[model samples]
Target chain A: MRTAVKKQYKVAVLAGDGIGPEVMAEAEKVLQVVADKFQFGLTLTPALVGGAAIDASGEPLPAATLALCQQSDAILFGSVGGPKWTGLAPDKQPERGSLLPLRKTFDLFCNLRPGQIYPAFAELSPLHPRVSSQGMDVLCVRELTGGIYFGEKGRTDTDAFDTQRYSVAEIERIARVAFDAASKRSNKVTSIDKANVLQTSILWRETVERVAKDYPGVTLEHMYIDNAAMQLIRSPQQFDVLLCDNLFGDILSDEIAAIAGSLGLLPSASLNGNGFGLYEPAGGSAPDIAGKGIANPIAQILSAALMLRYSFGEEDAARAIEQAVQQCLAQHIVTRDINPNSTYGTAAVGAAIVATLRQENR
Target chain B: MRTAVKKQYKVAVLAGDGIGPEVMAEAEKVLQVVADKFQFGLTLTPALVGGAAIDASGEPLPAATLALCQQSDAILFGSVGGPKWTGLAPDKQPERGSLLPLRKTFDLFCNLRPGQIYPAFAELSPLHPRVSSQGMDVLCVRELTGGIYFGEKGRTDTDAFDTQRYSVAEIERIARVAFDAASKRSNKVTSIDKANVLQTSILWRETVERVAKDYPGVTLEHMYIDNAAMQLIRSPQQFDVLLCDNLFGDILSDEIAAIAGSLGLLPSASLNGNGFGLYEPAGGSAPDIAGKGIANPIAQILSAALMLRYSFGEEDAARAIEQAVQQCLAQHIVTRDINPNSTYGTAAVGAAIVATLRQENR
Candidate 1:
């Protein structure tokens, strides 16, 4: 750690609830292995969140945890909520109480939900064999902080209303986020909206078009949300980066996850105006499998890879982790979630990935 | 000259534009055959609408077309619009000027978009053979007259906003429509909304819960819109009826169609509180194949079947028409759209369907 060649980074690891802690532990093991191999020093601070935080401190996102996260270079978030948190008020739920609040506090504006089916598991797809053979990698770059989710809502005597509002400045920033993402990947972005019907969508399309002039390296296309919904299944491989508002993003992101068939293989990143982010697996805590040690940990380990690339600018370390995951998947050293009869435990899969990294170094 | 025991019904036919006239002709031929076989008298009235109306009377939905529809028992509508009417202002477009006005005039509050994969052509599905072989038949009963589509929307200096409001009464009626449809099918209804996020959706869920008590014979379940989106592909056969708001319907209905592969096999109906309705094919006018006599007439013919069942109370007649269309598909008597290498034209397909009816009668 004292060597001039070594770089040090702090990560706030909030293992929220249920299977979250188990998955987080395995992810940390991978992070440690990569840190040693890449000559990087990692200092991880464990924090309680969601139901765990509620049990210990009577708050979902405790002040201590938030304080720790504010000082950290990155966040490695595990899934939150379980049957134990079911009786809480809607706002007090793990999602509304901790996740949304964390994103809001950090001013996270862009949510990247990337769904890619690893070639070894293409047969697991719900789509036709011929369709799955084409392969699919769609990154839904969603504007998280604005649009209807943050708009004003109210009730009247006979009616209840929620407003869907968007501003030019808000739209421009999200558009730039999407274009930059496209440049790094497929160099294509499909901007989704209901422009033919809604005024917000019309403005969204217009604003995205104006912002496209800055990114001459990326190609731009427009699709109605309705058609985009159908095209996701009809030809999911045709998509690259699907830029959407909060509501559409929530729906389409989940749709893409189901299309991939292997939910455990997916990871997500929420980025602020700067490149800093909270990286997490795009799945929920499995209360049913909690403490059983059989829950899938690959998504969690992949989230750590995303944190390296996006937060620490450790691209080499990120690729090493990602390639190790592909190696484990190819060898079928996965947890029961990916294969019903899989004998590997959460720890075993994690150890396999780290061993792969060591083997590659040899 | 008239048989006193025979019943008669007036049908106003609007063969709108492009492939509309060709498909409408085949549908009428089937109607003529069914009327003769069922001992029912038929009176068909032709009216101009869409681009054809625009060319004839300088309006998309002319007074003459409106007058004809008002006097008819049921309206059999074909596809509409083409390149010829592309220069008009937004409001004067064929869809906004004609179809919307007709729906508004008729007080059509409920839209039924039923998607069923033709049994013989299940291989055409984009879903995995294992997934599609489950045989999906989901009916999306949508509230057409209310919700955000009809709510107040405006733009200000810094923002553009749309209001999504729902009254209890509006939710109850649409819920009832879904439950009734479910009762006739698999006896299950999945009400979809973003209740946790939108206040309108909260009220919607509450109102639907209140209405479910009246439908004692039907099973009711609630799902957030995002989960429902994933479930549609993850396990499509699980759904019986999907009751949604206008915007959700606009997205999910199209999604269900894509699941089934060919849009030509679907038909839709828009009805007011009463049973009177306007029936139409689910696909759009194919200007590319227009006047080539090769457009698929099955959807247009099925629209007539929907008219018989929903509007005229001719259930047996409707089933006969439906079965006949199925036979046509089974026998490979389909248009080029359904089977590109086929020699079957618009007229040949119609004649083939009529021959099946005659054979079934024999």
Candidate 2:
């Protein structure tokens, strides 16, 4: 008798603090079910991070946790930071210490923020009836580790300055990420910048254009940042992928996420030049609702699904988890954040998605 | 018979191109009536600028026009540029050549964008039902002359850089402008910058704090640009005045204007430290709607009101003009953009406001 071998992969899971563990547990359970259904071997190595790690080891990003992530194929990150870590030094805070260092260590230069909305949840959208009626699904591909944020900045006797610097290589890589994302979706990308004023933006536009040659199947358009912000509010559905630098991306991504109505339901992925990635919820750790059993777990679960797709290269499994989450919403199985009257707890919503996957397995 | 001495003022009107002449004619008519009623002497100087200037002369911002503006007390500018000038070089284009040079010439360091929404038209807002129910009325005080826009920019072999520089004096002036604005309104000013990340922002926050002392009546708060964007969409009415650097202002002002439903309904004023300034419709010259007689003249009419309020110090006259414009909108005496099925045209809307003012005068 011949037996099929399971494709094995090691996953590092950091269930940070507050609602992190609760949400992370549900995501893990869903991922386990997906793996079982897909015949893939997946082992989750749980570790300390954020305020939890700080309390346990007096540091947000523990050396042991870093080693675990270094050895793993992918990272499934939970929300970090809470009131407990508020007094910590700027760089030592749960968010800054763990997340920032992780991105730097992993060379996670590109962050993909997808503002996707299901048809059933469109009513929750903040847009006008006519604008939301069309629906919005825009992905903001941001160059996370560069631009003004990471530039050399200081104050002189009379003047203060921050250098917004970008190289052709940096722009090329980020542009490729956007183009690649566009190729998978609507095959259209809008490179957003202030090229009329910023020299970095001029280089960004030129590099993005040069990178577009490699993506012949993808259509490219450049838009000024101001007009992009207005257009995003006016007709969000018109944008497929918004390729932007750090500052513009920071603003546009938040704008797009807010437009989606439910920030707790959005999943984000940070990627390096290689296929390796770290996936997490776009929202922060809800310390106020910690251990309440009512915290929204959809973002965490979807993040796990993203981990499977982007890092594990298990696209079918990712889609199955995504569809399961969407189906749960259709069935009105959600947490309080998504629906104030929702009866389902975090565990219930996770179980519902797992059950959906189990049904597909049969 | 003792007669109040007529206060004399010269307003340079640059009816550049497209519907510039059409809408400007209305603004001038309303201003003339206001001057007559308010017992003031006002003279208008029609000068050439933009593509129209290029048509009459060899340059966009003709020397004669600059001299005219220099001689005038204030500038009441109409819209500029059209398809006819699209083929011109980047610097020679009407928008770049004329508008930009005018800004530099006058040191128009502060741009005021008031996103005031009348309760009667809140249905046009794109925000969620709950968000727009309160209505929005926020003024964005943008530092127009400095920051990354006017900073040094250069390109190396593979990299491009733009230096975002801000002097103490620059930040102080803009901050004072914001605090002064808040004094007249809700007495709350939110200074937006990326202080946690950028050096310039640190200077900005400090300067704004120092300036807050000068206006003890104003409540000052600092917020990140990203959070500011979210808060604008989530609860715009909470903000009384938004103080920001050039780059953030460019993005946020447009965003705030978009939130108000229509750009064509917004008025803008660019001012120097002196009372001298230029008032223009925030919306672009719609070459498409040039001679249609269906273009919205409300913005231009409102621009004239802003000129009265900011440049000429005619508060009652400005309020009267504003009330008349609002009354026109309420009465459905609006152009095609505001109300498609309405029978009113550009001339009708302007004529309606003038008639309302005449009735008020009687």
Candidate 3:
């Protein structure tokens, strides 16, 4: 009899600084549980980044680490930058030195942030129960590399200017990501822009509308940026996927995160055209809580879930991990961030999630 | 003893269309009560505008109406536009033809929208009790004629662009409005911009900081626009005055209004350099409820109060009107939009507020 091998994925893991290594350990453990249950091969290569890399090699991102990332299928990033690296030149700081370079080098043009107010924890939301009770699951798909953020900017003695520019191809790709994500969820998308005022928005609207034809199953809706900001707070449950340009996305994503309540539970992904991605928690590395075994691991574990869903195409495994996290949260087996009354530590919460996933597999 | 002439204000009242006339009538009634209590001479001139002007003279903004507004100290505007004017061309539409022309003609570069969630009606807020119970009072001071909205824009076959340009003069004028408003309220102003990446934002921040020197009593804080959006939802009460360029203001003002709950209770002001202004409700002409007596008149009443405060510099009169409205809301003497169970109509609500004002004076 011939020996059979399970399919494998190599992910470069950058456990950057502070509580990163600790939370990442929990996410890795959860990934191991899912990989075993789903019968898939998983190889996670750990590499130094941020303050850790700086301490070891006098740089935030080591050449060896970048080479390793280049060889991997995807990057699993923990949070970066802490007070320890704040003494360095602004550009030499961990976040600026490491993450910016990685994103630029990889040409990561799309950013997807998943913001959700779990019904079990709806009380955490800033919105009233009438609105929060329905819960909100909005994925903000933002075009990262284009728009005013990366456009031509100049200043004179008397005035200053920043250009918001978008190409048809740029809008189309981000729209596809939104439609794809929407198709997997509620099959609806709300494309936000100021079409009545800006020429870029007019082009964005036209391109997004054209992209809708390709995804026949997914419905598309257009909303002005101002109205979208209001609607997100007034009725967040009405939105499934929100597509935005760089500047608008930067605003709305933070707004969504605010309404979602706990930053510890949000995960983000940045990707390129080739489907290669870097996944991480939207929350920062809490230097204050580092080495205390009390940091929330849900964001990291969810980032791993996103990695499985987007990078590896392991939908079943991804959902299983998501359900496990939800179950753990619903059961009140969460870290202090989610519930101050809960005495659970990072390892305990991770174990509870793993146990839930294993129980579901059986 | 010689008879003294009271300080008089010339106001052009443009009750445009639909419920505009009815709401304007109630607002005028409230204004009359305040004028009598405060002992100020008030000269009110009636003028045609919007659909009413179009019906009378085949133009949304009649030349006679413009001349009347120019001659007055301020314009007391009722809501404009209705389904009746939908057949007109986009440029000839009631809203575009009237308000845009008026704003442009007067060089109304500053827009002040006051969004507040009264403590009595906290339940109407989209925010949780923990957030809304404290009540929110944020004045959004926006640069009306600068930034991306009025910037150069164009489209090509492959791409499109919008230039967000800001001059020192533009930023200074808007910042003055914010600082002056803050000096009247909490003496704190949060300037919103994207200074990290955009050159225009850098100029905006620099200009605002320079302007702050003139108002040493007022404290100044700078926040990135994205963080401002998040902060607005997270802790709206922490804000007193929010200063923004055109685009940021457009988005934040709507968000503020949404969180404030009842749009029928909000008021707005657009002013030029000379203290001349156009005061209006931050809502529409509700054609469906035009002839019905059920239309809420608080917004229009509040607009009159803003006119007294900004245009005529009658701060005491303004505060009196505001207090009367608040008393009516606290007593549940409101229209259907605010309280469905309340039986008060437009005229009745106006009468109740006037009664409250008269009672206070007695």
> Which candidate wins on DockQ?
3
Per-model lDDT: 0.88, 0.90, 0.93
Interface DockQ of candidate 3 = 0.94
Candidate 3 accuracy as lDDT: 0.93
Per-residue C-alpha lDDT of model 3 across residues A1-362, encoded as one tens digit per residue: 97778889999999999899999999999999999999899999999999999999999999999999999989999988888889999778999999899999999999999999998999999999999998899999999999998889899988999999999999999998899889889999999999999999999999999999999999899999999999999999999999999999999999999999999999999998888899999999899999999999999999999999988889999999999999988898988988998899999999999999989987
Report how far off residue A265 is in candidate 2 (Å): 0.1
DockQ of each: 0.81, 0.84, 0.94
At residue B200, what lDDT does model 1 achieve?
A: 88
Query: Sorted by TM-score, highest first, which candidate order results?
Result: 3, 2, 1
Where does the lowest 10-residue lDDT sum fall in candidate 3 chain A? Answer: A2-11
Clashing pairs in 3: none
The window of 10 residues in a row where model 1 chain A has the poorest summed lDDT is A149-158
Q: In model 2, which regions exceed 4 Å deviation?
A: A1-4, B1-3
Per-candidate TM-score against the hidden true structure:
0.95, 0.98, 0.99
> What residue runs in model 1 are displaced by over 4 Å at the alpha carbon?
A1-6, A88-95, B1-6
lDDT of 3 by residue, B1-362 (tens): 98778998899999999899999999988888888999998988999999998998999999999999989999999988998899999988999999999999999999999999998999889999999998899999999998898889999988999999999988999999999999989999999999999999999999999999999999999999999999989899999999999999999999999999999999999999889999999999999999899999999999999999988889999999999899889988989998889889999998999889889998
Clashing pairs in 1: none
Error of 3 at A358 (Å): 0.8
> How much does candidate 1 score in TM-score?
0.95
TM, chain A, every candidate? 0.94, 0.97, 0.98
DockQ, 0 to 1 scale, candidate 2 = 0.84
After superposing candidate 3 on the true structure, give the runs of residues whose Cα lies further than 4 Å from its correct spot. A1-5, B1-4
